[model samples]
Target: MITIDLITGFLGSGKTTFLRKYVKYLLAQGENICILENDYGAVNVDMMLISDLLGDHCDMEMVSGGCDSDCHRRRFKSKLIEMGMIGYTHVLVEPSGVFDVDEFYDSLSEEPLNRWYKAGAHITIVDAGLRLPLSDTSRYVFASEAANAGVIVFSKTQLNNPEAPSNILKYLNESLASISCRRKLKASETVAKDWNDLTDEDFKRIESAGFKTYGFEKQQVMDEHKYESLYFMEKKFSLDQIKEKASAAINDPECGGIIRIKGFFKDAEKGWMEVNVTKDDFTVAPVENGQDIVIVIGEKLGKEKLAEIFGEPAEVHAD
Candidate 1:
């Protein structure tokens, strides 16, 4: 049976960044691994970020977003079953931020998959310097996702947020209480070191961080939740211009609770560059190649108003 290690976290929690590091570590251990990106977006920008990691020791696959919950899960299971036939010893799953955790276990516990794959590490990455007073929906998501995680790794501690480390813990426990989940994170089970400074020993611990079978209040999420992602293809804008417009949408109320804006476009001088922005940080980095598209993710998004902000999208894929 192949080991399927899951890396889960909330939106903009740096799951891709951490997964890149974890994949490299597995390859070093002589582990032939496959990365299954179960993303919830029209276009998976993350795939481009990790494309360079593809080679003999590792392979990559993705289940695209913009489908109903049941449809998405079926695709996820089908993809896993297909990948199971491959000769890899391990499969790393990076699901979308608002994924149904139950699907991860349910799919693996079924007939053919049960015989081919067993569960491995279940790690959840969190933003250390999180600004509090997150919407009730967002807080519920934060606790719900981390409820069964065997290890909780905090990101962006190196930036040194004043309220971090301690503040984050208090908020997490409170969020868990709201969800009525009995499980709570202990300090011993968490890794708070910088990603660059993370030693092999730290990764070894994460590798063996088997999941905890904990239960939480499972309510109908889609009926109440209003998360969305708006995509714009073939937009002509410089890096500076896009950043300015992205910041406006992220901060403005007309756009509705916008959480993250990310995508890629071509520039005159830089050729191809990626636009990755969250409420906390704004970063535009150069890439070798990219699609001329942008995606904006948030809850209860005002579609038409946003279209006016970033110009009309060639296509719109939303839930």
Candidate 2:
């Protein structure tokens, strides 16, 4: 049977970063692995980054526009079956940040999926800095992720005070105790640690952690209009200029509530550059070679406003 590990987290919580580290370890072990990347946006900029990093180490498949919608759900299941047919020892599923774990579990219980694959581990990535915002506004989704996770990993630990993650973990333990299906950890085991700081020994525990079962089922309804994406192809713009415009667009009242902005772009000075933006941070670096594509994901986006800000994109649509 194939082991399918679900890596879930709320928006901008660093799911991709966690996956990158795990995949590197898996590759070193000579594991036959596959990655199923699900993105809420129509464009898969994360995939581009993943490909650039991983190269030919593993097979990759992407399900764009999320798996929540009925059409995409069916497509997602079909892809699983296809992966099974091709044969893989492990399948790493990186669901879109806005996704619900319940939906993932429900799909696995059905025909074909259950026959071919087994639940391996449930890992949820938490952003140490964004805990409060996540708890306040996205409690349902945030809590649901924690409730279903067997091992909870944290990101952005280096950016926060040393005492903050403990407080956040305490809050999560209290908030999720009643709903979480996985076994509870003692106070000693509840602190959140940085992904980079984790050693190989640490990962063995996470990957081999016992599978969990979730019974609590309060599903969070997705606000369809709340998330939208704009895609740009072959757009050549100065990185500084793009950042300036994106900052303005994200701050604009008409295009506020932006969650993530990332893509590969052609830099006038550099060869190819990749940009990743979250609520807390923005990063840009030169890549050897990559597609010139820009994908912006946010809520309440105004096309005209964005066009003016980012210099008229090739296409804009809902994700």
Candidate 3:
């Protein structure tokens, strides 16, 4: 059976960042790999990033829009069938932050899917920064993702002290205990690491241990909160300007409780920069890409205010 790894996390949790290096490692092993990019939004921004980073070495198929819809699930199943027929040794599934973790596993138990592919690892990335904010009822989607994950990994660890992950791990375990989950994950199954600092050995350790995952039943619950994505077309802004605007936008109540802000932009003075912002922290790093677009993900965002903050030619869409 082909390995089917579910890479899940809440908004701005670093799923794409982890996959960039993980896919490279899989390719080095000479394994045939295929990626099924499942995004909740109509736009495939993550797919753009994966393509820019991995290029032609990987096979990719995208299932865009809300996964809760029957149409989306059919598309997803078709993609899985296609991958199986192609005989890929491994498949990496990157589901949107708002995805239903149980529904993902349930899809596999159905006909045609179960015969071809066996469930592999179900890893969820956690943004240590937003650990507290995710507790709100509006953020139940995030909680569900955590409750079902086999190996919970932390992203943006550099922003915190060495003990932060351990501390957060304890907090997460306690949180999971509070909820009546269908499956239980051991402490050893949860890990914390900075994607930038990972070495080949680190990847190997994760893959070796993470592949053994616990399965859960689907709940079929839909997020009551709205998730919207705004695309900033113009990218020529100073690093300071971009940071300042992001800070202002996230803090403003009129902005409708912004949860995640990410995208590639060109700093007029400092070259290209990648901006990733969660409620806990904001990060701006220089990147090699010349593409100048920034995608912001959040709930009930103010279109006019976002357009003004992100600059002109902003296109807003449902995720």
Task: TM-score each candidate.
Answer: 0.95, 0.86, 0.84
Which one is best on lDDT? 1
The alpha-carbon deviation from the true structure for residue 301 of candidate 3, after best TM-score superposition, in angstroms, is 2.3
Candidate 1, residues 194-261, lDDT tens digits: the string is 89999889999999999998788875554355677788877777777788889888888988988888
Worst 10 residues of 1 by lDDT: 219-228
- Per-residue lDDT for 68-175 in model 3, tens only? 556677788887887788878888999877786656777899988898887877778876655563534334565567775657888878787887777666656555
Tens digit of lDDT per residue, candidate 2, span 1-319?
Answer: 9888999887778888788899888877877889999766666666766775444558899877644577677778878888899878889999876676766777888998899888988888888877364433356567677776777777788889987777777666665654544545443433267666777888887787644665554543454544566776776666776688667876777865677777777766677887877656788887666787767776566777777777677776554
Q: Score residue 256 of candidate 2 by CA lDDT.
A: 55
Task: Provide the lDDT at 90 for model 1.
Answer: 92
Q: Please give the RMSD to the true structure for each candidate, in Å.
A: 1.6, 3.1, 3.2
Between which residue pairs do clashes occur in model 2? none
C-alpha lDDT of residue 82 in model 3: 76
User: Between 1 and 2, whose TM-score is larger?
Assistant: 1
Off by more than 4 A, model 2: 52-57, 66-68, 134-137, 170-191, 216-220, 268-270, 313-319
Clashing pairs in 3: none
Q: Score candidate 1 by TM-score against the native.
A: 0.95
